[model samples]
Target: MARPYEPGPSTSLSTNTLSQTPSSPVPEEDDDSGAASPELPLTMSASVMLADLPRDATAALASVGGFPQEKVVVKFKPVGAAPSLAQELCKISATRKFEEVVRYLRRKLRCKDTDSVFLYVNSAFAPSLDEVVGNLHQCFKNGQDQLIVAYSMTPAFG
Candidate 1:
């Protein structure tokens, strides 16, 4: 059988021993020391400044160079009993808002002022009218290199 273990004496800590140690310094409290410390100037090394920035910040700065705007092709797919248009595909400026697509659909359908139209992408979800069409196309485009948008005269896909 193994002998029972015994703890070494150095493990014990007493208040008197802790106060008498040369490395420990006791803080002095001053009730009148309410003045704020002086502010330091904001200075950072190049490597540290780059490291502290968000990952996308560098990519965004790189894209600031001159870039030409490209048009995107949007293919409209009617759902349920929605009327089909003679033209199913249209090209729109990449920077145009999604509201332009909705307006174009309404005009093509000759819908009344009170009629409601719902637009969705990939038969999945409806995007906000303020969303950029180019961004949506870039993210949700189909294999045919076109943005597939499904529309209905009434509420179809939630």
Candidate 2:
């Protein structure tokens, strides 16, 4: 029997990091010699499974009133794969979880919050709309019954 795949907790998945590099003579508070913060810079991305589907794409755009246009991306593979594919997959995943990805980018890269996150789309790889919608609907139904919060996240503060 083909065992079904299960997703672990999403906590570790949040990849928010500083968007910019710190400037100049490192702010020295007292003479602690050479001590650096543990926090490091990182990039953000995501991946979705389309095991039994067609095509591959990254993101779709949605307009939210007042808020910036929400750019939702789709990824057809899991977290790890070939180098190039993995990078693309991560990009897509990042788009889906825009807030988390942006937080990481801005925090690590020191990018401005106003900067636009170009959600990439691997349309050459994504599955068809019918399959995507159907699978999502089924997942939604199952999660609903179990009261699973599939894709909820906390708000980010500056």
Candidate 3:
């Protein structure tokens, strides 16, 4: 049978770099050089595993007040040398994927299969093709209640 383990003086070694008795509960003082010690005291905090959901998914779902509107207004803007559309604004189904917007732009521009087009939301970021249009509208809609989409013939915005 194994002997019961015991914590002796040797086992309870000083974990801190400062010279202090084991019984002392005081924190070590800063150095005369006016620099704080690199070592920091350990702290315990409780955390919860929020199921099998990503942080953005949870936050997006939480911020949206209710079901997305049936349709969302998308206002397209041309960047760089890209051609402008006669009708700059159009209405699209909210539940449609972002790929629809891309396809629509391509059809309007009469682009060939080899031609590449880039789209950005609020002229800021290029979202995934599979992302929902409603979510994009909800997140980046302008004061005029329209989703501002900046289109380019090549990768433009950062």
lDDT of 2 by residue, 1-158 (tens): 42232323322223343654323222233356465322322222222456653333322222211222223232322222211222321222212333454343334334465653232112122223223222322233232221111111221111
* lDDT of the candidates, in the order given: 0.77, 0.28, 0.82
Prediction 1 global C-alpha lDDT: 0.77
- State the weakest 10-residue window (summed lDDT) of model 1: 38-47
Once fitted onto the true fold, the runs of candidate 2 whose alpha carbons sit more than 4 angstroms away are: 1-96, 121-158
Candidate 1, 1-158: lDDT as tens digits: 43333322323445797575433221223467654222312223212434466778878887764224488899999999899989999999888899999999999999999999899999899999999887898789889889999999888876
Least accurate 10 contiguous residues by lDDT in model 2: 147-156
Q: Is candidate 2 or candidate 3 better by lDDT?
A: 3
Residue 100 in model 1: lDDT: 97
Better of 2 and 3 by TM-score: 3
TM-score of 1: 0.61
Please report the TM-score between candidate 2 and the true structure: 0.17
Candidate 2 local Cα displacement, residue 122, angstroms: 2.7
Q: Which regions in candidate 1 have their CA more than 4 angstroms from the true location?
A: 1-69
